[model samples]
Target chain A: MLIEMLIDLTLACGVVLLSCLSLSAQRVFTAIVLYVSLGLLTTMIWARLNAWDVAIAEAAIGAGLTGALLLVAWRRLCDETAAQPEA
Target chain B: MFTKLEFRKREANRRELPPFAVYALGFVVIVLSVALMFSVVVSGKAAPKLAGLAAEKLEASGVENPVTAVLLNFRSYDTLLEIAVLLIVAIAVLPARSSNAAGVAHFCSADKQDVLNPVLAALLRWLVPLAILVGGYLLWTGAYSPGGAFQAGAVIAGAGVALSLAGRHEFLWHTTAARIVINLGLFVFIAVALSNALLTGTTLQYPVDYAGMLILVVEIAATVSIAAILLLLFTELKAMVDAPREGRQ
Candidate 1:
């Protein structure tokens, strides 16, 4: 009982830290990485809560897919900017 | 009078709430929310048991797994509409890529990535097949286990994304054959449901002996279509990021 609570508490703290860091990070790329971390922490939270169904969805779609999409979009956007001549 | 005017100007320059005050207010809100969450967690009433009800009807529903019975038999209509809703969302978020246009750019993308190319290719060489295997296993296990069509489909979509990242992108959902795959679930569902209705009097009411086989068939189609639709959604966004201004068809 105590161990479970401790784990949940740690997950909650990690989630909070990552989420705040995601918002406060200077670079968009760094912020996105933090957001992915936050999603992962949230996935852990869902698993801790014993909602396996939700946990899976959160892990796959939330962290995995979202993180990949964000990184790809960021890279593409950077490429577009690089291709354009500076005004 | 000069001292008073100077004090007023200083007051005007000051923020309505100082940074310290803002932080304190945010801290308070966070604490309150945390307390609320704790209270809810501590006092949360356990959800009433539906397993018994599900168990009682499981035999008639024609599935051994209670969850599968609940989703595919007892509440199959919801699953049907859920897939339709997914298709609609995919359509809405999808960029204006033609059936043939999105395929041209990825042809050379693998060659451009000098260092990552070999690694990604080597990894996907094994990973994609493994993903397919896992997805199929999950689907097949749904009859008496926890895995199901949606889970299987998501796994397959993950594999497709990996393949895309490796620059072996198929844009499978963009091709004519792919659209049919995307709609296969919905088409099969309607056909099964209508046939059931015609045979029986009620919609989605499968025959007692045939319910299990029919549900499995629908599940397979749903799994394939769902994966295709999700991959399409993933690839459509990718297409937007890569080829924004070109190939609108």
Candidate 2:
């Protein structure tokens, strides 16, 4: 029971901290990276909740595919003359 | 009098936060969220849900996997509508002048094959088939496992997407073949619906003995279509990205 509680606490704190960092980060890329981590953490939470189907979908589509799409879009935006290529 | 350095340090120490009103708003949000969470945790019931009902009725659904039976048999209408919605959304948000990028299909010049091409090509040559294999297994196993058409489709689409991003103009990405492939899922799904209605005398109802095989067939077609559709979208985006470079030259 104590171990389960510790695991849950660690995951919960990680999620909350990652989310807050993603939201408050000044650099857009940093936020995007943080968001990907947050998605992954949520996937872990889904597994912990015993929703295997939700966990699979979240990991594959939410984190993997969506993060790739977001990064691709970000790269495209950077290529555009107007957008600043933030580090 | 305070030194100039002390004055600068004092100014640096002062950090601005959102007003008290914002914290008040945060307090409200926190309270509401906590209350909602409490209700969800407290409202747990010991009664069985539809899992028992579905399990009891599973044999009739013609699939060993309860999840698959629920998705492709008992609640097929939901899946049908979901795929239909996906198709419509794909069409509705299609890129303008999509064919303008058709020239990209032939952009694979010998000079362009850099150090990355051989490496990427080697990897893709190895991986795309693996992806297809995995997707096929997932579709086949849907009759007995957690894998299903949607998951399989996503896996296949992931391979197609990786290839599409490689920026190789050799692939028939924006061609008529691509369009047809993209529509294959809708065509097969509708064919099943129509055939079942005409032959079985009911809509979306499969013959008991052939239900598993028929669903598998639909899943395979959906996987192909999904892969093609995702590739099409990615190709369009790549074209947009490539446009400026072409214009500059």
Candidate 3:
């Protein structure tokens, strides 16, 4: 019981820490990567709660698709023209 | 005219909070959180919890899985509206067809720039089939297990994403047939609801004898549409990446 409580405590703290770090990360790319890790951690939390259905959906949609979309959007926004000033 | 960076920097400086103000805000958050937790702990249940009630009715809910029963049979109206919202999003993101061609299919024509690396190509060859198989299994297992249309659809869409990354597969979302497939889930769901109303005098209330069959049919159609819509969202967003480059050149 103590070990289980410790594991749950660690997960909850990890989630809070990762979320703060992701929000305040200097680089957008690092923030997006951290955000994906946050999603995966939430998925684990959902599983630990015995919500298998929610866990699967979170892993697939929340973490996987959202992360992929964010990465692509970041790529598009940070393209050469966007980085360079007009002549 | 200010550059975006300069404008953003100015805005940031204007909006910057003093250290004391930041601490004040943090204090407010902590106090509110404590108050909320206190309310939750003090709350008494005036009404009996619904979990017991739901369990009692589970036998009549068509599916063995309570989650499936709730989603598809018990509160199907919410599910219906959710699908409609998804359809609206899918339509909003769909690219308008180019004038030269009837559809956006030509945009993804396998040019040299679209080629995949050999290792990724080999991985996709194995993974895509496995994903499809898993997706189908999830769909089928939803009736009795934790899997369902949303999970199955997401997995299938993941396969489509892998194919898009591989750069060899062509998505023909621009075609009439593809559009039909995309809308089929919502169309079928509404039809089922209306037909149930006609037959049973209540919309979306499946007759006990036919409940399982109706739910299964609706789930199958939903899985297909959900998968198609998700794949379309990914491909259209990816095409946006190439679109600005083309216009500039």
Candidate 4:
């Protein structure tokens, strides 16, 4: 029970930190990275909840696929931004 | 009067709090309130009947892994729908032509030196294959263990990403073969579902003798497709990085 509580607390702290970072991050890439970390933390929390299926899905689709998509989109946007001359 | 104007300007220059501050605070309050409500009103063992039914049905699936049984048999339709959703998302979010060009060029030429540090590359080379092996083992033993197709696919995709980053394969991102590999999973899934519907009068239902074989085939296809999609995404990002700098004076 003590271990479980510790795990829960750690996950909660991770979620809060990631959320704050996501909000404060200036670059789109940094935000995407934080979001992925949040997804990973959520997966750990799901694992602790004994919802192994949810945990696997969260890790694979949530963190892995979603993060990749966001990064690609961000990179594309960055390129577009660079191509436009400064006003 | 000039001093008063200067002071007013200084006060105006001091930044105001962002408009999102109020929304953020409200969101936190809503979440906390919801948590409190759940704690107060939600009962323990809320769905005992459904849980009991699930437990009773588990033995008939012939899978030792409860999660696997739930995913592959009991809630297989949901799994199928989820895969479909992923495929649809991939299709919908495919980069526009300029975006695609930008991504590919970025990947093909961008400063590899910064991203591909020697130590990290060596570490990845050592770790990636081991990760693949573990993922495969987890997938193969999923019927009797905690892991399954998604976990294995993600692991394999990680290896693919590592390989791409290490520059192990030039055509990893930009090839007809890559596109085919990515689509293969959806194709295989659809084919199986259609065949099962024809053969068994139900989509995705397999003959008792061939259940394990069917699952293995699906898992392999899923792993390949996932890896391809991930690698393709990375390649697209690389293209973006290399694109704008090409024509600059």
Error of 1 at A5 (Å): 2.5
Ranking by DockQ: 3, 4, 1, 2
Writing each residue's lDDT as its tens digit, candidate 1 over B155-234 gives 88899888776655546444456667878899999999999888998888888789899989999999998887787777
Q: Which residue pairs in candidate 2 collide?
A: none
Top lDDT hit = 3
lDDT string for model 4 (B103-210, tens) is 353222434455566787778878878978977886888888778878787777767656655654443333455557768887888888899899999987776667
Considering only chain A, what is the TM-score of each predicted structure?
0.88, 0.88, 0.92, 0.92
Could you give candidate 3's fraction of true interface contacts?
Answer: 0.62
Q: Give the DockQ-based CAPRI class for model 2.
A: acceptable
Which segments of candidate 4 are over 4 A away from where they belong? Answer: A26-30, A64-86, B1-36, B92-124, B172-176
> Every model's Cα RMSD, please?
9.2, 8.6, 3.8, 8.5
| Model 2 global lDDT (CA atoms, 0 to 1) | 0.73
Please provide, for model 3 over A1-87, each residue's C-alpha lDDT reduced to its tens digit, 9 standing for 90 to 100. 999999899999999999999988877789999999999999999999999899999998999988988887777667644856655
lDDT of 1 at B167: 58
Q: Which portions of model 3 miss their true places by more than 4 Å?
A: A80-83, B1-27, B44-48, B99-115, B246-249
Sort by lDDT, top down from the best = 3, 1, 2, 4
- Using TM-score, give the best candidate's number: 3
Candidate 1 vs 4: which has more DockQ: 4
Which ten contiguous residues of candidate 4 chain A have the minimum total lDDT? Answer: A78-87
Q: Write the residue-wise lDDT of candidate 3 on B1-249 in tens digits.
A: 001322233347547888789889999999999999898788956565677777789889888988899999999999999889999988888767644444444423444566678899789889999999999999889989898999999999899888886777767676776788789899999999999999999999999889999999999999889988988888887877766778888
CAPRI class assigned to model 3: medium
Among these predictions, the greatest DockQ belongs to 3
Task: Quote model 4's TM-score.
Answer: 0.73
Between the candidate structures 1 and 3, which one is better when assessed by TM-score? 3
Q: Candidate 3, overall lDDT?
A: 0.85
Clashes of 4: 12
